[model samples]
Target: MIRTALWALGWALLLGGLLAATALLVLRQVTVLHTWHEYLIAAASFIPMLWVPLLLAALGLVLRLRGRWRLLAATLTLAVTAVTAWPMLPAPERSDSPQLAAEGSLTVLSSNVEYGGADVDVLTRLAGPEVDAIAIQEMTPDFEAFLAEAGLFERFPHRVGTAREDAGGSMLLSRTPLELIDRTEGTAFDNLLATTTLDGTLWHLAVVHTAPPQVGAEAWTADAAAVGAMVAPYTHGNLLLVGDFNAIAQHHTMRQLTADGSLRSLAAYGRGRGEGLWEPTWPVGHRIPPFARIDHALAGREVSGPRPVYETVPGTDHRALMVTVSPSA
Candidate 1:
């Protein structure tokens, strides 16, 4: 009876290992999930992709009694974790390309920089002369004073729009002399467009802070459509739309801007080891970027710029996106 029990337990361990492997690996590629189901699956996949490897190793310890099988189970578990959790992990080092810099690509940093409890000293330290233009959100009166003390008011001679204390107030700072063309108020949310001439070529920079996704799906839908309409006409020129878009890159709302054949900056330069593409820029000033890529710096084909720089900026929950553009480039 004792021997029979031992045999049964051994078989059970092997079976569990086989079952976990099959579920985690074989069934992952199935295409039966619908659109909504796919979204749910994507959301669900985000966590387990990190948990499964560790779980597998733990399970392997419980199930494997001997040499070869135990090693196999542990290796498989580690492999799974590496594939899923690697991209989500924090990349502390500077990941920008020197090649792109040598070619004179503009790197634009877009950061929310949370309104309350912001540190201007930290922001200034992070934002070196490498930054060409800054598009900021959540700039309170106090934060404005902070920037002024830091001498951003003088450094960036070209500017546009007032720093409104209200919800629609967004601010833009540029080194190039900029002319504020229009600040479109209340179609859905506030957006501003300014033009600067570089080497006789006119370039339009649209600074936007759209309604948050939590404001309601209908509001976001309308706001996104309006933003699309505003930028659609400028697709032929050197136009760049930058700011806290407050939506994911994959979301339907952001897709509207690229609908006019404009180039998405992140999608263009984001390559290699998943680090380039996983631009999670929220919950700023943290060790690891937040799980959503809400902020963006989008460029059209006519805009001659360098690769987009998504870096942690001073005093905000978002990173500062900086890009340098030249007329001849």
Candidate 2:
């Protein structure tokens, strides 16, 4: 009886885990859930794609199921795994000769500095002179001074936004002249808007950090949607938006905002090709590996950019995101 009970418990665990993963994947691919709870689930949509297959395979061996039963379990696992991974499959490289630095191109590095505690030397080293812009979220005054002292702010003299000692602060620094566009009012972190000439072409840039969904689903959605609407005008032209969104692309708000096709993310760089394609950007420098991508370098329709390059910085909770944007031919 004890052996039978153990077998039953194993089966239950296997079934439960797979079902939960499936639900999360579905929410990512297509979700109608709107509440904060649902939004939280959607944000975690990628975990299923990552672990379901491996976990199930391990469970199969442990369960010691016989012939047909084992075959059935394997088939079920494969089918579900494929479905979960479909949305993240590669979108194909846009350029064969992707340049690291180019004329008339704007390369930007964005980071959520975790209340100004990110490693100053490391961030400055990674963001060498080739980087055209740097967008910072959670820019406490101390962090601003740190970057300034490091000569980072000097590299891109043109700037917008302000530095506060709280999460609400944001800033954008550029190598060329920048014109200020009003920051979105009434946001946890105001979306900083500005424009600059890149190789003689005007390109709009937005440095954003949306409110975390945990604050409440309604607030998160409103913040996300408002930022999207505020930037709608520039979506069809030379535009760029970057920073920690606190919400992944799968969230209903993000999906709605990006549905117009102007905002494109290079998160699919290595999908299905044996490379680490689903790069996650949050919870870095934590007990668990960073597993969710909540930060981005979103490019506009008339603009193009390479897959975001991520690097871990000491003391920050997010991997810094970098990408270069140019006029698409």
Candidate 3:
């Protein structure tokens, strides 16, 4: 009876692994799985450690199967592993061209201050000298006060957006003069639109913060799509959309934003110093490493040479995403 049970358990594991693999493939191809299926896939992409279950199932089959069946089971396991691992692969090397250097460059820093949870001193220290503009999310009154006390305004004289107690607050600070075009503070998403001149060339910048998906499925989907639509107009020109997106690259919402091929993620641009295609950038407080990269700096096709660098903010749950953008020939 014990031997029979072990064999049955092994078969169950194999069957389950195969089914999960099929589901993942289907999720990738279809867009209608907008509720739990979408959320689960997005969460799995965020915490890839979740793949351990499938791995364990594959191992069980490898141990239980015999002869040719054993070989077939091992192959199936390998396929599952490969498909699951594809999204986490290292990014390709970016081309270094003289033209990219010849064009005017803009350095922008996108950070989530975690509603005064970050160390103000660290932000002040990092923002000066290197950053041309700073896009911040979760800007509370306490955080604004800290920025004032730390003399961040001395470097970034021009500012926009409102400070709120909720996670919806957002602000954009720049050393150069900025012209405010539009601002939105809605229940779904918060955005600030402004334009700044870089070497006499005008470029649009959108500071965005989407509501967390955990709030509700409909809210999450609407928020992501709203932000995408808000920035769609600027894609034809030199634009930089930066903020705590609250969604990963694999999420269907994220895919919808980049579907038009106008806006492209800095990490996914395939030209950066980072090894992996995605850099984890949230939940940085408690000495625990971040598992998902929710913060992003996306550039339009006209923009080039955007190399993203991530830094941990002293007291916040998110790391700052810094990147330099330049014009493309």
lDDT of each: 0.61, 0.76, 0.76
Q: Comparing 1 and 2 by lDDT, which wins?
A: 2
The parts of candidate 1 lying over 4 Å away from their true place are 1-82, 89-92, 95-109, 187-189, 267-275, 285-289, 304-307, 325-329
CA RMSD of each candidate after superposition: 6.3, 3.9, 3.8
lDDT of 3 by residue, 23-79 (tens): 665665564464464466464453444355576688679868889988997997798
Q: Name the better of 1 and 2 by TM-score.
A: 2
List where candidate 2 sits over 4 angstroms from the true fold: 1-6, 36-65, 75-100, 269-276
Pairs of residues at least 3 apart in sequence or in different chains that clash in candidate 2: none
Q: Could you tell which candidate, 1 or 3, scores higher by TM-score?
A: 3
Q: Could you tell me the lDDT of residue 37 within candidate 3?
A: 44
Residue 298 alpha-carbon offset, candidate 1, angstroms? 0.9
- Models ranked on TM-score: 2, 3, 1
Cα displacement (Å) at residue 159, model 1: 1.5
Model 2 poorest 10 in a row by lDDT = 267-276
